[model samples]
Target: MMLSSMTLSRKYVILGIAVAGLIGSLTSAGAQIQYQTGQNVAPVYEGWMHNDDGSIDMVFGYLNRNWEEVLSVPIGPENNVQPGGPDRGQPTIFVPRRFTQPPGERREQCVFRVRVPAGWGPKQEIAWTLTAHGRTDKAVGTLDPLDEIDTHVIAENRAFTITEGNKPPSIQSLKADPDTVTLPGTVTLTARVTDDGLPKPPAPQPGSGNAGGRGNAAAASSAVAALAFMGDASLDCR
Candidate 1:
């Protein structure tokens, strides 16, 4: 039976709509990595920092799917750097559990942040990847002179810079309840961290132009550091 022209046109239109929808869905899925329990997303380079030591430090971050899932990936296969490490010793990433987002928010939280030595000539590339339970996602960054990262603009002390006399936060104590627990049971973890870098508000030094109004102003960042928390995280105790 020969179909009418109108019926054939309708059929073609319906098929076109279905194809378009499928394409859109695929594109969206590819745009952002989806991670879940036993699965992980890719790592992204936020930017680089210039250490006091002349070497550039590559800052990387990643996402974890489950809210209660913690993760700890080392600097090796699955998540590694080319040409090997300078032995700066990348820490086992400590990713906090995921959390709920409020309305109108659309940024993925970086549960993990780490820095590695980067200065292997122009071709040096760092690849941060996550693969678990048969799923994999990876992100690569290069230190090439002509690479996408504007290393020139990322001058010394541009964003995050550490200099002499800088001290990191200290852990007073860390405790975990029911360290050894049966299956289907839960454990509680707690940490006590403190930083003494903050200085006590000092009295104005009586400067003519109020230059000393801001105590330790010289140590303060020239520009406010902007940080954003995106979505949630995964579950793999670091």
Candidate 2:
């Protein structure tokens, strides 16, 4: 009986030690996984703005505590005004710029804008923020913030000048229509415009007029146009 009792005690002791070791191993593994995953586990935000002229603009940047402009690009402007050129009718606006973070820094700020529709009100302004982590491969101590905005309002009204043969007309809105009409008088007709924020089809000439560089700039414009008018189904900007 004495021997049996001693054997039972030893067995219990061995089981206890094994269980403790297993628990310790699991705890260590969890710590390692957490360490491997860098900071900031959040989703980035993106903003989309749509204009009545069948054009769309997209502005994207990071935000920390407040709104920051990271990058802004206007898409359909190039194709409508330029006459077979990428940016002929499009306004010559500054492209959104990016900033580089120095070592040990974990946050950044950026800002951008979209042209308001003809009758947008002050209350139409919309803003939002999001968080994301493990975006960078370097395993920085902190993560970055993603800002997003999607707003709709009346298009802005602007004056356009008509040259000798040019017509004085304006873009009202974009819709699906399949009809054609001929006017009685010899009036100049301005073509209706629609854009999805994608790059306009490549202009016939690369650098002839408003068409910018041949690479990403052209492609990005078209992309933005496509995203804007396509109804926010694919893009989360809205």
Model 1 lDDT per residue over 1-238, tens place: 3568889999999999999999999999997764435555445565555566766666555545544345566555654544454222333443434233223322243333344454545555666655544566765655644433333343222333444554554655377787786756666656555555533434445445575554333333112111223212223323
Clashes of each: 12, 37
TM value for model 1: 0.40
> Candidate 2 at residue 155, lDDT?
14
Give the Cα lDDT of each candidate: 0.49, 0.33
Report the C-alpha lDDT of model 2 over 1-238, residue by residue, as the tens digit: 9999999999999999999999999999976652323243221223445566844443433322112322222344311211133332222222122133333333322233334344444334332222233132111111112322333111110111222343322444334233453544232223344343322345454444555654333333311222112112122222
Q: Which predicted model would earn the best TM-score?
A: 1
The whole-model C-alpha lDDT of candidate 1 against the native structure comes to 0.49
Task: List residue ranges in candidate 2 displaced over 4 A.
Answer: 34-238
Which residue runs of candidate 1 sit more than 4 Å off their true CA positions? Answer: 1-35, 65-68, 72-76, 86-120, 136-138, 144-238
